[model samples]
Target: MQIFGITSQELFGQLLLGLINGSFYAVLSLGLAVIFGLLNIINFSHGALYMLGAFLALLGLNHLGMNYWVALLVAPAVVGVLGVLVERLMLRHLYKLDHLYGLLLTFGLALVAEGSMRYFFGISGETYPVPEALQGGADLGFMFMPLYRGWVVVASLTVCFGTWYLIERTPLGATLRAATERPQLVQALGINVPVLVTATYAVGVALAGFAGVLAAPVVQVNPLMGSNLIIVVFAVVVIGGMGSILGSIVTGIALGIVEGLTKVIYPEASGVVIFVIMIVVLLVRPAGLFGKQA
Candidate 1:
């Protein structure tokens, strides 16, 4: 006797799992979109930066007795400041050149970051304890879902949409968008476009760092964690179209659900299904579902 006459626990479980994945995707893709749209760089270091955030949070918890809530806020600040330093010292210089150089530089940064972490940590992976407040489960009629997952879904949605509001409806956002499209003109209007650029990059990286804090309990906190998710995230970004925050958020969550459903119905194809859709979308809609058409 199913709730609506159609009941499959395995499928339901997969969806719950997918939604959790979606939360990560939403936050990560949002970060990617923020950097791409505002800073005009691929930010290949994004994944590594995320891992760094997770590691930082772990360090905070273990060494400094910092709570997850505190680490969530602080890690982003720390990572974001580093992002500012990178932009100020290196990324800012490549703005006038072809976008490829920025991409390559970020890729190099990713490699360096991953390598350094691997050297220090040896890739065994570390565990992050779940916050005590979220260590329970809710029993639905059909299945039991973890409370932590529900927390993740709610918190992630809030952050994603909150960011959307901040960037789309606010006066500060107008300056940011204007800065991205016409720095010279915006600068003429008395907004420090370069400062805004630096701030934007910092903010984007901070978002990634925040995501890492949220994800620490779910995934292994290893140096390789960032590289692992970055590929799928890039696919999400590609399908959603770069520089589109809403698109990324929607696509990431929707695709996660689709992937969840596929895993229940077609187990073997689950891994590559998103990529397959991506290829098909590329052929059918070169600019992607939300990208601007030529």
Candidate 2:
């Protein structure tokens, strides 16, 4: 199978890998975008939270012999519960202050979480094993893609789009949006606006947790993982304008593949390409590819 003399197999292979990477980015950025949109907080701890998810999954595996499927169920719930506790105890206080304070607080929280993991797990990274069930490749005529990797791509996209649809096209989503814009008005209607806000934050963090669990098999689970990839995610959110969920999802996946393709060509430039794209996008359309300025 060849197209334009470029083997369809090779092209599709890279594209598939790119889409997998993009799915993680999309979901991760979606979490960031949600926090930014409603809480007006940058969530500097997002990367830390993500690392925590993977670490927690590793713990489930090592101590309890839990496999990927069980870890997938357990890890996110634990992390999400932690998120809700943080919201009730920490973020709730910052909601009335300057956004920078929230950023600083979350930054400190990230440091605490990452440092604790390093203390226990050591600074060295840990590996996550693939289950026997997802250990083979699927031949699709044009490409032979790994089952685990393909699942990661599909699952991430499903979660990302599902969240978007829930938020953008549902009655509950309408109320959530309204609450973000005018909390007092929504509260006056007898809705627990603060509780709703906290729930949204927890949901966003849980999505991050899910990403971490899914990512364990594909990437090394490490204390430093968050710091390693967070800046790129932040750039993705910025480039997508953080004003639109769809923008974040699309831009994240597109940029990931763009980076992957760059790796195939000029490997040296791959590291900085995302930031370069960010700068270009900001200069041309500060609102981002699918965003609208407030």
Candidate 3:
């Protein structure tokens, strides 16, 4: 039962946890890649939107007497609408300006959201109870797998692949890509490029919201939650290449597993390992593992 100096059960457990983290990373990065690749905008507020999603879920449970199922359905729609408003009111004006303007605007938005939440909810996190349905563990020979965690992995991957297929393999995805690369031409062809852009941004942020709902039961639903993970997600985006959707998914999962292994072998390095990997990737292939050369 020993693998290296660790028990197989322990090793597998770490790997499973890593995979769960990777699932979140993959989904979040996928959303980032979609926004940046198509909209040419850096969504610094994505993490905040994610926080909002979890909070919204909490609000539903506390005030609305909604269950987890209802929160899962309502939270993303609410956040996605908020994203549309942000796009229409603010992001649209900045598209003609430098990308930095978009970054600054979203970064400021992130700050405002975090600050507001901190003021209202304080720095401490609100606990979200796992649904009765997913509240137990299953033995998997090597290790006992938490049902919620397994659900997270499966749900995340399903969403990731579904998004990828939508963007990479569908006609609507083709239209969106065309709009991104040749907006004037797409517009001339009678497609509403502006509307498409707004929709894309909404979809991107909605993804963050979806991830937040998935994560609410696992982690403390604090305002700083998204801020803390966004940096790592950005690193994942860089490592996977912003241009490649598949790259982001694969890289995120791989790094998560690597981080998990690091936790077992060298606990101190767990925190910094992803960043170090990012550094190495940049030095070797500046475009990223899946990014094309500029």
Q: How close is every model to the real structure, measured as TM-score?
A: 0.96, 0.94, 0.98
Clashing pairs in 2: none
Checking candidate 3 for backbone clashes, the offending pairs are: none
| lDDT string, candidate 2, 139-191, tens digits | 88767889999889888888999999999999999999999899999999999
Off by over 4 Å in 1: 1-7
lDDT of 3 by residue, 27-71 (tens): 899889989988888889989999999999998999989999889
Instruction: Report lDDT (CA) for all predictions.
Output: 0.90, 0.87, 0.93
lDDT per residue, candidate 1, 169-193, as tens digits? Answer: 9999988999999889999988888
Which window of 10 residues has the lowest lDDT sum in candidate 1? Answer: 1-10
Q: Is candidate 1 or candidate 3 better by lDDT?
A: 3
Candidate numbers, best TM-score first, in rank order: 3, 1, 2
Better of 2 and 3 by TM-score: 3
